[model samples]
Target chain A: MTDTITIDDHQVPFEAGQTIMEAARAAGLYIEHLCYNPAYQPHGSCKLCSVKVDGVIQTACTMPAIAGQKVESDSPEMKSRRKTLVEMIFAEGNHYCAFCIKSGSCDLQALAYHLDMHENSFNHRYPVRVIDASHPDLILDHDRCIFCGLCIRASRDQDHKNVFTMAGRGKATRLAVNSETGKLGDSTIAADDAAAHVCPVGAIMPRRGAYSTPIGERYFDARGIDEIDNASGKL
Target chain B: MRSTTPQGNCDVIQREPGQKIRIASCSLAGCFGCHMSMLDIDELVVEVVHHLEYCRGPLNDVRELRDVDVGVVEGALCNEDNVKVLEQFRANCDLLVAVGACAINGGLPAMRNHFGLTACLKEAYLDAEGVVNPEIPRDAELPRLLNRVRPIQEVVKVDYFLPGCPPPAAAFTELFTALIEGREPAFDEDMVRFD
Candidate 1:
């Protein structure tokens, strides 16, 4: 049985096993999501989708909407909190979008634009990451990694190969190659493996025409992912 | 498909393709496009060459394989020979640069380290190709190939890394000029894909 949940002053229906994110989307609400790509399973790592569920700030992406639940998807307090959260991600990682190959076409960049995040609020977490180019078809630049874990799932599910996995814990958690020697190039991953591709950031990109997209003609402005998503009936 | 030049060498470069400083390099076992991108600098080639040397064609007038001021090395060190070639340039050149995705991270060639070398060689030459005898040759002085390719840094340290499939030629020219001027290269932080 699906019933409406009291959210703020309005009532939004909650369906069984319906994630708050999906319900909100169905109710015509835009929640900030970067790592929780619909193509893959919901990865609530970004924490940008945090909403006040029954008066507690919880990740809406992972939490299920329950009956009689009081939710606050957008509020002045939530807006600032979400903006601060996004700023933290931006500052923590070296998200210099202008030079990035994924600059224009990146979801993070689009979200930043959507949220009006001009200045990074958090201090830069200058993590010295290793660049793994072991796979001939793709490159792994950890410096550009936001810990989205899209590649990990794509490798396991779409490619039918467990080539990429998360290693360590907390801030130390990083994407590690499945090689016993702890090297990606040495892994059994083929050139066409999904792990070798599908990097949201330039952290994973093709080797042939590396930055061939040129300056003025990047992914975002050139194609406009929002327009593309709308055209593809995704957004 | 890539074509060879009339001179029997792979003619991957377009002749007089503008005035850009051309650096013909190779990525053995690693991605080979680093050198190809140098030519891909397209119309910017001439502008880039205006700032540096356009060393192309028969290494004749170039004379002596003396150390170049700025050398771009792509691919990883899979064998001793790869190490030697990289080492020579590192020691001889003023600014030994590692370009392309391979030289930066061992790239796709390094993926072979997961499986046995025998499996990889067999799959490529014996299983797929039209070769009769695929076993190791007796008189082949081919240095022992490693089970995987590694970034150039693992074998020999590099002064700079111009990453990408093969980093854009604009980057090469900018980096080369910056090093020559004894200045830290000014990269448009917006231009590089840090992720």
Candidate 2:
């Protein structure tokens, strides 16, 4: 008999070593996350997937699924907490969705809409950051980066380029390039690398064919993030 | 102008027995696109006028805001004059609604927040490619600019916020219809958009 875990009252069977996020996702449940891509190792940085397990708060992506565990993810309290997390992400960066090419397709924007986040409750930081446009094919706009480390993991683990790394600490932490010149243009990352296409926001963008698709006709325009994720069976 | 019969019968709209709901709207440091979207509510404006009185707005050309039931504000606070206008709206109106991305999060204009105010003024007046007379304009008539552009809620309490580049006309129509009926406005999934 397969051991089962309950996520929001739905029973999900999980194999040994599978995380709660994996189990929940396999059961066709959406837990609302940003940093927990299935292709990479679980990164618990973005706490948008924080859920209560047995009445204690835990990150669903990193926590191992145990038999008879009760996970509460879609409760009112969890939704409110997720809203605050999303708001902090917005306020921490200069996210001007109006003009961004990634407006309709960006996960951050889609999550905000999904959570019904009308206004950012916190004060805007408006931090000044470098826009690294020296790269021939890629433009790394640091302002939109949420520091999720997806690019870092993709470049290091998949592409074997080790081109991206996080530098500094706390509010001063930033995505730094691995070249001696400390610039993306001087790095070995290629345009076709998984790192180039893995960013959830507008931080890393290819220079060519940016505006080929109109804003209203893009990914999240026709369906909410949850609906799309459910239908596609991927985050 | 007064008309007893509405252009089209709207069963959802209901007004107080004797008093018409007074409304005021303004555009601060914005492009007035939110106001344009409000106008894009189209023929619904005909029904809106029957139950709501335009005390101060682009529709009525009234300068003073006083004793209004609702105040619709667009744009962020970029200058001293904009702040004063927002304060006036908050003081005179019972309910204040932020109508767009600019009013809620500083939108496109807030992009300048990354660059300091001094750099912005200098770049515009002196460092730009075409500059015959390089002088930062300073007159008592001109309102002083704030150090950073901010949403209206930062300066005053906002009862509601409709988020969009300019919230779709359907969002405004729903909000107005709900308010006129004395019910809380509920936006559909498609009605709330960031871009």
Pick by DockQ: which candidate is best? 2
Evaluated at residue B95, the lDDT of candidate 2 is 79
Tens-digit per-residue lDDT, B1-195, candidate 2: 111121122233345696788889998878989998988988989989888888898767889888878899999999999999999998988778898989988988898898989999999999999998999989999999999999888878788788998999999999888877777778898888887
Q: What is the lDDT of residue A104 in candidate 1?
A: 60
Candidate 1 chain A, poorest ten consecutive residues by summed lDDT = A226-235
Q: What share of the true interface contacts does each candidate keep?
A: 0.00, 0.76
Question: DockQ scores for all the models shown?
Answer: 0.02, 0.43
Q: Once superposed on the true structure, which residue ranges of model 1 sit more than 4 Å away at CA? A: A6-11, A214-217, A222-235, B1-195
lDDT of 2 at A179: 99
Local accuracy of candidate 1 as per-residue lDDT tens digits, B75-194: 777887888767766665655566765565555565565456788777876786677876653356877787665666655545566655556666665665554344567544332332
Give lDDT tens digits, candidate 2, residues A1-235.
9999989979999999999999988888999988878889989999999999999999999999999999999999999899889999999998999888788888888899898888888888889998999899999999999999999999999999999999999999999999999999999998889999899888999897676777667878888877765211111
Top of the candidates by lDDT: 2
